[model samples]
Target: AQSVTQLDSQVPVFEEAPVELRCNYSSSVSVYLFWYVQYPNQGLQLLLKYLSGSTLVKGINGFEAEFNKSQTSFHLRKPSVHISDTAEYFCAVKGDTGNQFYFGTGTSLTVIP
Candidate 1:
């Protein structure tokens, strides 16, 4: 089984400022890491994935995350943000087969201008 923990439930920031959303996971086997963003009353969209190779992975909306095996963390970060970036973010883990997905409760990013 796999599980994810998002350290913060809400993060507020100013427009064009930097932001980071923390995430941690535990699994018995190799898995895929993903970050999804959900807009108001909308479905989640894939931000990025760490399938293999580099530990640092980039995604949409100027967001990026680095996979840390030792710490079991995949923290999302962006140097600058926009008010439009205001939304909910979720961190998820999928097994090798990439079938079932386990997600964190969610982190709401409120970008104020």
Candidate 2:
């Protein structure tokens, strides 16, 4: 089984500032890591993912994450943020065997103007 943990429940940042959301996971077998974002009253959208090869992966909306096998972490980051970036972020993991995915609680990002 695989599980994900997001240490921060909320993150507040000024516009144009950088932000990083922490995510950790545990799994007995190899897994795929993912980051998803949800806007107010909207469905979740894929932000990034780490499937194979390259430790670093980039996704839409200027977001990127690094897969650290040693730390069991896949943290998402943005060099600069905008007010439109305010949303809830979730970290998820899926094992190689099944279609089921384990997701972290979530982190709400508020971009302050």
Per-model lDDT: 0.94, 0.96
- Candidate 2 clash pair list: none
Range of the 10 consecutive residues with the lowest summed lDDT in candidate 1: 24-33
Structure candidate 1, residue pairs in collision = none
Compose the digit string of candidate 1's lDDT tens values, residues 1-113.
Answer: 78899999999999999999999999746778999999999999999999989999999879999999888999999999999999999999988975899999899999999
Candidate 1 stretches with Cα past 4 Å from truth are: none
Cα deviation at 9, candidate 2, in Å, is 0.3
**Which lDDT value does model 1 have at 31?**
78
User: How many clashing pairs in candidate 1?
Assistant: 0
> 71, model 1: CA deviation in Å?
0.4
